[model samples]
Target: MASTAHRVCMAMLALPAIALAHGEIVVDVGHTLAAPGATSARGRSEFEFNLDLAREVTAALQARGRSARLINEDGLIPSLKARPQAAEGAAFLLSIHHDSVNAFELQPWQWQGQALDYNDDFAGHSLFVSRDNPDTARSILCARIIGARLQRMGFEPTYKNGRRRAYADPMHAVHYYDGLAVLRHATMPAVLFEAGVIKNRDEELLLRDPARIARMADGIATALVACLTAGQPADDEATADGPPLQPVVE
Candidate 1:
């Protein structure tokens, strides 16, 4: 008869490996409905853009045989501080957002004979990761992979930040934003994607188009699949000593 330890080891070996395709992915819409983020050049709320893209991304992931959840509760349900905790068991968390420039950069314009704010100076998408997260390495890896896919899909990345912006490198199109609440607090690999600069007149219209949104969703879904299947990157170090970073409104 086998020893008790040997029997236990054998039983452990008999269990099947967890499949990456079945891992839970939480797609977080950037802001609450009541506090909808930046306004687009056309007067559209950023929350609308974030919610739409997050839903599409969730659908795309589900179609690819991945378990995806969208965490888009109203301001009353899960407060901003609670959103990340809501995604506790997820393997990955992706927060979707639309970018806007500083007020100083915004130029006054007349759209349909009405005064509107617009900023055509900067355009394109951006990716962000928080070093404060427990899975910072995996988060960075995921961000890089998604950024690469977005670029391959013919979408450029924004690299222009005026005086006030400090989180991004601009040159690499990926930012190390330790202050972002969602990314910083997530226990799993977390990334925040600024899909595009909505303040740019031309980009705002593109962001509203269903076809473009779908294409971007497909790219994001593909990146998520690749990241899971490829496994987490080699750098799995976790840091807990840094000063807590402030949260930046998306």
Candidate 2:
């Protein structure tokens, strides 16, 4: 009886070590106030969307007992190359941004008496990896895992970016965008997630929904843990430990 008790105690004590094996993940909020990536159908800046979702993702990762941090949370990261530099020492880097359509696809509109442009043609999320990265293999692996998980969570992948020329995994919509500065320059495996096309009015509203934000964040967090510990034995205790994240209020 004492021997069984001792073994049980040892297994309980090992949980933290198991959780720490995944290392730190840096969640990069793509774009800055000065150069916000895109404008939403209603004229909101993409930086606003990126920052909010990145925070939720970081929170979700932490809830899983993983070490995750956020960079450019303040909207001050100055340059493309500098984004990855800020993520040094992390095991993985994920840059988050909302998507947009090409200028030709956008039509002029009026919102709240202000002129705006919007495209209703595109309406889903996309994932990108850089073949030029030093850790391209792992980057692709991580992106594929994320893409698959996102789809399973009911998030559709969109190819409206017109850059489906090099899909690392077409079914899940993971693309190889070789020149992306953040992915190319990262010292660790990295992926750039275009969360959804904000220029699509319907998608813009959906992306802003608090419950959907929580779902997306939770899905990404679960996928990251799975990717980082892919070869290890399944830990039912670890996988089932955390509760679903609450909807983000902001």
Candidate 3:
């Protein structure tokens, strides 16, 4: 009878560790419907791009046996300040967004007989992390792994900042965007992914491609699984100070 009780206790203790192996990841869809982010060269909203990619990434992670959730809202849901709160207890949080240049870089154009904006100058993806996050080291590590995977899949990392010269701090293709509220406030390791420059006509078409999005999703999932499985360092061992930012190149 004692042996049976001991065996049951051991089984219960082992279940949680096994569950921990497949950690929960929150896939945040950037921006809200009422305030959708950057408009594409072809007239698509950044929110559309963010939602599609977030869904794809969630699917990819689930297919790999990982627990992933998409923080999707029906309408003008949560504000930026409240978004990070949804990620509490998650092992990692990834905010998906599409990139665009400043107003000064926008060029006048016509699409379907309507005046449109376009900026084809820069064409690539970018990753960001915040210095204020409690788990900055893990955040940086996760970004590096994701950036490396994206590079391996033949996707380029965007370094172009349009007219904003201060935005040019690149370290291993990951930029330090410390002011971002989502990354700064999230309790767990976080990363903001600018999948690509949607304002570029050619890149807009690429972002719309289902195959391209799937490939990108695969790369992200691969990196995430790798990072989680490798395990994060002890809080004391990791530091908030990230790598030195290099000069911005045109």
Candidate 4:
């Protein structure tokens, strides 16, 4: 009993050392990270270029001496088709998405053929996750960490200024009981990041810039290492601090 107590004490002392075993970060491009099909409108959704962004971030993380992996977008389809699988062997899962006002386009002539007097109030980017307890809070915090990094990187996002807050009612804000399929079905604590307003023409043009995309990836990677996993620091911290992102012109 005396020897066992000594060993247990040693193990307890080492807990913090192991706290940062920072596992792999699995990212699922909201649409599909793999090759795009003709049936699927490539580069149409906000995530059209997500895979590319993933690659850049993956490389950056590796360069900074972080252990990470990218799950093929194909693997995500099955999970999205239904409830998430068991988190079994993952540290975290991140889903990248882009939203536009296109959802309203599908439901035109609302309110007795009179268009609803609603403005496309939603603008800029947001980092969101589930609202469940403990694990969900941690995931949401991780998303918030990324959001903080984004702000540090000089993207003055307009925040959660959407007209609606519930996914059933709001075109966006889908990350809980009514979240997007991928976010809902993620086996692990997952976050969905709407990088920008793809619907806005000005924001749409910003997406085309490779530099901005790279900055976004770097910001994501930095946030994951600095905040999410507590990975070992390699050198100077590099964030996605680029130019002030322009608002999407209607």
* Top model number, lDDT: 2
TM for every model, in the order presented, reads: 0.83, 0.83, 0.83, 0.63
Clashing pairs in 1: none
* Order of candidate numbers by lDDT, starting with the best: 2, 3, 1, 4
Candidate 3's residue-wise lDDT over 189-247, tens digit each? 78899999998999999999999999999999999888777746444224344432433
Q: Model 3, residue 207: displacement in angstroms?
A: 0.3
- Candidate 2, poorest ten consecutive residues by summed lDDT: 241-250
Q: lDDT per residue, candidate 2, 49-145, as tens digits?
A: 9998999999999999889999999899878888889888777899999999888889999999989999898889888876556555566667778
Q: What CA root-mean-square deviation does each model show from the true structure?
A: 7.9, 11.9, 9.9, 12.0
Better of 2 and 4 by lDDT: 2
Per-structure clash totals for the candidates: 0, 0, 0, 3
Who is ahead in lDDT, 2 or 3? 2
Per-residue lDDT tens digits for candidate 4, residues 1-250, read 1244443442342213233346666666555434232111113534455566666666777776777566554434544543234333455767666655544442222444444322244456765554321134345446657777877897656435344332211222323332445444454556777776654545656765789988888887888777555533121111111121222111
Question: Which residues of candidate 2, in runs, are more than 4 Å off?
Answer: 1-20, 162-165, 231-250
Task: Please identify model 3 stretches exceeding 4 Å from their true place.
Answer: 1-21, 73-75, 162-171, 231-237, 242-250
State which candidate, 2 or 4, has the greater TM-score: 2
lDDT by residue (tens digit), candidate 1, 135-247: 56566667778888888889898876423344433443777777788877776768889999999999999999999999999999999888776745542222211333545
